[model samples]
Target: MKVQAGELLQKINYPSDLKQLKEEDLKQLSQELRQYIIDIVSVNGGHFGASLGVVELTVALHYVLNTPYDQLVWDVGHQAYGHKILTGRRDVFDTNRLFGGISGFPKRSESEYDTFGVGHSSTSISAALGMAVASHYKGETDRQHVAVIGDGSMTAGLAFEALNHAGIENSNLLVILNDNNMAIDPNVGALKEYLTDISTSKHYNRFRDDIAKVLAKISEIGPDAYKLAQKFEKSIKGTLLKRSNFFEALKFRYFGPIDGHDVEHLARVLKDLRDIPGPKLLHCITVKGKGYSLAEKDQTKWHAPGLFDKITGEIKKTVYEKPQPPKYQDVFGHTIIELAEVNPKIMGITPAMPSGSSLNMMMKAMPNRAFDVGIAEQHAVTFSAGLATQGMLPFCNIYSSFMQRAYDQVIHDVAIQNLNVVFCLDRAGIAGADGATHHGAYDLAYMRCIPNMTVSAPMNEEELRNLMYTAQQDNMGPFVIRYPRGNGVMVDWQRPMKAIPVGKGRKVCDGEDVAILSIGTIGNEVVKALNELNAEGYSPAHYDMRFVKPIDEDLLHEVFGKFKKVITVEDGCIQGGMGSAVLEFMADNNYRAQVVRLGIPDTVVEHGEQPELWAECGYNAKSIAQQVRLIGLTRSMQTIAS
Candidate 1:
């Protein structure tokens, strides 16, 4: 379906084109841009609500600033859709987040306007400050560096650290705090409340613009007047607001808790701030899903709602013939509740991923036990460690890629102390569509290297339950259970949980010629390959090595004794994952065998469907079957030569 952009938006091919438009016409342009995003995303899905929320701000920024030359850094890049469409990417906007298509986030390589690439939240402030400092050093005094970060992202310590440093620097940096009160899930922590208090204060907001106007007028006249104006403004703010301004205390000149949806006002405010800025902040309060009614109502659901009906507001879902298996995160969400019901010690914690990690289920059921710790991955790890120290088994559910941020915390706070913290790493493999930044590719490799960290992955939902149960058991120190995104193979997946023996391998089937060792859900691909290979008269045994750290040495020895041919498979990196563990075992035992490792190669794999990526990485079912055929052919040639 061909969706036409509104007349004003159709004229905008670049920010230069946007600059050509009159300030009065920006509102219409914002509306059209928002609609275009809705239309393109409705047919070809990517991130939804975030882009809609920032439509006016996007228009205002481009209209006021000389972009490409002037830096604009989007925090998480979830809200960069409008920026992309305006900056010479409108024609190809339909291909967003596809296999070889454009990224969902703001990528530096994608366009000159995208000053910094971002996927993780709370990075824009620091990144833009650095750019601002560089511009100052290069004698580019006229150049402006802006970071548009959301309130949810503002909760992170990195944003605060940058704010502290930026306050002292004499750089042309403007931090636009996009206060939507959201970050995938609703924003939590004291920061959210502080922003809310400022936005809600009637006296503070009403007199703010008037006071700023007077201060600006007074400051412009003379140096003595500027000093008097600073003292005067501080006294007035203290009297009216009855609080020390957070940003102002850090030495930043703070402005606005204004209506971000008002395009004209925003454009004018942005123009004013461009001149007076050393290090200043604009607090723009905007709805996350401004125009869309359904999206505005349930912001989280519509965050990245896959292919929805633009008019009716019905989100598209795959229709399965029979009862399908639940997502691994869903299994974790529900099973954690089940376990917590029995074990009083078990608690759930996720770093602003209650919905994404499916920990919302527990949060709803046991509110006190489960926590949404804003976007602080590092804090979440240490918080879980604190809970563990109190004899409470905390299941710190973080996305595998996000876990990279908390590596030091995991090692220092949990693993070093041997704390009884269960780390539930969701999205443990190639997270489809979101791209390389979001892919959970390194957890298996990274986790295994940490001493006292018992790294493991589940083969199915039943195993996930069992693993979750096992991790909370007495004296289980810093357990890590990594699982992939999407559904398990079993239709009826709600099996009763039972503790499996640690470091044990389970044989899936018996065969003659070759043995296949796999860990986690990738083992299912090996199972599918075994069936096809069996039909082709190539017999191969299958074993699932669930735990990666304390690997099943006995099972590996049995396989080495039985077969001369071995193939190891995993969903993680080929270099240091389960396949590498198998090879290490083979070398340690001095067992001679022809081994082939099948997993993600040492290269950056881009965004695609899980099947497409697996096939591309040469670890999918078809790829596994092809590998078996090649091995069989080689064995036959050797026998014939002999």
Candidate 2:
């Protein structure tokens, strides 16, 4: 059915509009919403399964809760598409995840209904509790606060910490644990088992209700009876559960292992919970990729379904001119597999990003050696450090942005000990569409500051492979080889990989008029810019300064002497980035040259396409050439003045 403009979704602009919807009408509305999401994502690809899994939950929440006023914070906001569509963004769904369009995740500025901006996982509970506490302080006791967090996210320590704090404070907060039994891949560890026990327990709800009713009856017997009833209820719950009362121990009133797909059931439960309060946790069981058959069968692949034939549920594989080398993550995955194959001491670790980090390949190849430590970035770092002490070459793969969670761990555990752990920092630059929270802009800045840490970024796939080999070989201190997301330069992998010299850079394009010092995956862009400059009757020297840490003094002095005008480009913040390093070096040496820094601005960059981000940051060929030409013209004027 073609989506008609101003039909079912058009009439409903906000949560208030949704409240007018009949309970029976919500089933059709959910269908429309799912189809709309499918239609939008079919063209503009994004997190498909996540949104699909939360379709009924999204509908139920909006139907029951008064949104915008009743704060609903979504942890790792990738699943907030249905929320966005329901809250006045259905018409613009076509432009989802595109440059200058609707974000893939919730943004505070985009909609008032999006109470908290979230991209990183396990933040909803803390944020929701903060809001709930604020509301209490302000004496807005009627306002409801709900946190919708995935089972995957619940694995993070921060969630547990928030639960602990909220429980103690007795904050008026509702935490909805959306358990899909999958976090990118099947969620591992003891928590998954605990959740399974909760979901499958048949008499749990009946027992909980009976206990609550008994407590209510006792409360009617007056103040003395109420105190005795509370003690009896706590003892009974403790004896019946017998397990580590995870949420309740943290002080949250645990409710449900409810059916997430059944919208009516979810609505009834949410409504009941709305009446009762004080740090409540609703555990709703959902299936990842709920509706679609293929997605249901293979949830991991469907997690972020690519452009596919909606009818057939088959992804369309596009063929390139020359079959390119796999992504940097794939190379890392394969490299680790090879290393693990040879050395039994090697262990691989990823923080719930098995697919994204390409650690699945390693996990499959060496099951015992590889681990998907779910959404626990801090834990992953410390875990690797423990492995390091036990004579294991622990290759910890995590997205650069996520590594922010373990900044203290990286410093305290790994760096301080000078452990020989390999930190494979993937997406260490402007990760397009996912936006500011996802962007790996500050990795260089953050990683560079850590003592006994060697930070290296590869210019191409070969260099990335080489760097990985070097990192494994060097049993010195902790080494981090940062690589950007997506395929690297489409280089030939058939060629034998060679190890790059550590803390060294190589000249890519030779010129005399000006020098362009470039870093990371942006080297290709810099090369293109230099080519454009040549076309415009100028020859600009280009150097791919692969390593950010150990300043290449010889290369810096040579480039500074050769060209009076120098421009530094990186896909990171200009402050404390590659450009800043160069500027600091020049200052230390007292070398005065006209320096231009091209990078992501100090402020947060919004969601957009990778190429669009590059263009916006003046890292694209045309933009870089324009800056060079401007500088050249100014130099010519200066020469004439002299």
| TM-scores vs. true structure, each candidate | 0.98, 0.94
Positional deviation of residue 405's Cα in model 1 after best superposition, in angstroms: 0.3
Residue 154 local lDDT, model 1: 93
Per-residue lDDT tens digits of candidate 2, residues 64-172? 9888899999999878989999998887877788898888889888989989999999999999999999999999999999999999899999998888788877567
Query: Every model's Cα RMSD, please?
Result: 1.2, 2.4
- Clash pairs, candidate 2, are none
lDDT of 1 at 340: 95
Instruction: Write down the lDDT of every candidate, Cα atoms only.
Output: 0.91, 0.84
lDDT of 2 at 189: 83
**How well does candidate 1 match the true structure in TM-score terms?**
0.98
Compose the digit string of candidate 1's lDDT tens values, residues 1-642.
667889988888988888888889988888899999999999999999999999999999999999989899999999999999999989888889998899888898889888998999999999999999999999999999999999999989899999999999999999999999998999998889888989999988888887667655664687677777778878877777767889999999888889999999999888877768599988999999899999999999999999989999988898978888888989999899999999999899999999999999999999999999999999999999999889999999999999999999999999999999999999998998998899999999999999998999989989999999898899999999999999887778888889989899799999887898899999999988888899989998999999998998889889999998888999999889998888888898899999999988999888889999999999999998888788889889988999
Off by over 4 Å in 1: 215-220
Q: Which residue ranges in model 2 land beyond 4 Å of their true spot?
A: 5-7, 205-244, 635-642
* Residue 277, model 1, lDDT: 52
Clashes of each: 0, 0
User: Which 10 residues in a row give candidate 1 its minimum summed lDDT?
Assistant: 211-220
